[model samples]
Target chain A: MKELWELFSVFFRIGAFTFGGGYAMLPIIQREVVEKRGWASDEEVIDYYAIGQSTPGIIAVNTATFIGYKKKGLIGAIFATLGMISPSLVIITIIASSFMHFKDNQTVQHAFAGIRVAVVALVVNAVVRMWKKSVKDLVGIILFILAFLVIAFTRISPIIIIFVSAATGILLSYRGAVKE
Target chain B: MIYLYLYFEYFKIGLFAIGGGLATIPFLQELIQKYGWVTSQELVDMIAISESTPGPIGVNMATYVGFQTAGIGGAVIATLGLVTPSVIVIVIIAHYFMRFAEEPLVKAGFYGLRPAVTGLIAAAGFEVARVSLFNLQEYLDTRKILDIFDLKAIVLFGILMFVTNKYKKHPIIYLIAAGVVGVIFKFG
Candidate 1:
């Protein structure tokens, strides 16, 4: 029980201080979990990170679950995961509730309009980065365009596109078209 | 009933959004169109706020949507919905990931997944960009090409796009800069 509390508190601090998401949380997690507490070694931390990134869901929560379980089993995983999310749960609720009250104010509305465009800029930046990282080969390029066009032009669900791409990737790998 | 629905829908998001916080945008866009719970502008605002504030964007977004729909209890449920899959899936992966880490199927799966997810995000970005920069309603009413563009928003988008690409600072910095510009310009 003491260890569980410790796990929660440690993750709570990491969750509270980190800005951005996924990759942003990695260094903080490394400092707290590896350097400070000695919960896991640097190499171990990197291994957890690899699994954390590939698996489904938020990377931070996934890493927390892996580490927590490594230390104290399933219950520990629950506590650590909860700790990581607790700050987000509290902070977003407060802001969301408050924003509703001020949403009608003219000044607030103008600020949001500007912020929205900035968000578009952010989205464009994200796409460029993702493209440079993921869409490397001809097969990847085809999938990228196909996925974008299908989702944008048709009402077909994004999930279908994802599954089809996964299958294509697997088939290509087996057929020796791609070594990855 | 609605609470359960929120949980289930977000659960789907958790299961599917394999990359990270930003990856959830496409799924959230689907919800926005299917359910009318939030507007396109509101979704953009949520992205800004979620990016600016601390914590994971996925969790923050889930909480925001939950609160908007069903209050504090709703926030908890939606958040749990989002993280539930992470806890379950990660626990399982931690046990066998060492062996599976080098497996070809796993590598190939992600090889394909990474690009498609990129495409999904790109599509979603196009949607966000369209909504932020265009005035579709006025264009529909007036049938004029000029009515399609919001010059103020377009200018801001252009300046921001240029500066952000060049500077490459934290998103919070850009968000604040844009907000101040909006307030000064009174774009609303």
Candidate 2:
């Protein structure tokens, strides 16, 4: 019971504070779960992230579920998942109720205009950081460019892109192994 | 009936919205077209609020849409439906594939997926930039080249980029600064 409460509180704090979503939540997750709680090792957290991204659902929630299950079990997963989403539930509800009242306010409009542009910069920063970490070799570069162009230009689904890239990776690695 | 519909629709979104939070945008767009639950303009506003909020954009969006369509109960139900797949899948992976990462094929999959995810994120960034920095629809209507560029927004973006790279502060700081500037200059 105590452990479940702890899990909820830790993830609740993480969910409440982190601003930019999956990638931005990493540092806080590392701090609370890895360093402070010793729930999982650094490498394990990275693995969880990789798996979380590859799996269906939001990466942040998926990661919380993985770590929670690792610590306790099904019950732990429930508690952690609840904790992670609770903040969004509360905050968004408040905003939704209030936003209608101020939706057309001139000051609010100006603030959102600024906020939107700032968000663009933030997303661009995330891209640069992700690029350095993920795009390592020639094959990676090609995949990155191809995925970007397809997603930007066409109506093709990203799910298809992810599956095709995974297949390509397997085939490429298999051929390289044969050559060696 | 509405509750069931919310649960079913969001369940599908959770099942398929791989990559991350921003990936759900396309799905939400489809929902708008199909259900007319919210207008396209409202969707844009929701995205703005989601980006600036505390939690994952996907969860925030689910809450927003649910609240719009129904009420607080709807919000809770929608959120639960969206996360149900994730909870089930993660638990299954934990129970069945304890050593999943050690598998060579899984490693290979990640090797390919990393770059692909990067590209997806880049595309998302581009889409956000398109809406925030340019008035494409306005330009198309006016047929004016200068009307295409939001010059003030571009300037603000450049300045924020410089500050972010140099200072490395928490993102909220930049967001607040931008909001202040926007209020003063009446950006919109």
Candidate topping TM-score: 2
lDDT (10s digit) by residue, model 1, range B89-180: 98887777645857888677667877776676567666756766899998999999999998999999999889977885656577668889
Every model's DockQ, to 2 decimals?
Answer: 0.43, 0.53
lDDT of 2 by residue, A17-65 (tens): 6565675666567567876789987556655766787789999999999
- Clash pairs of candidate 1? none
State residue A20's C-alpha deviation in candidate 2, in Å: 8.4
Residue A102 in candidate 1, Cα distance off native in Å: 2.8
The TM-score each candidate achieves on chain A is 0.57, 0.66
Q: Model 1: per-residue lDDT, tens digit, A8-62?
A: 9988977775554654554456457876789986545544544565678987888
By DockQ, the best candidate is: 2
How many residue pairs clash in all the candidates, one count each? 0, 0
DockQ, prediction 1: 0.43
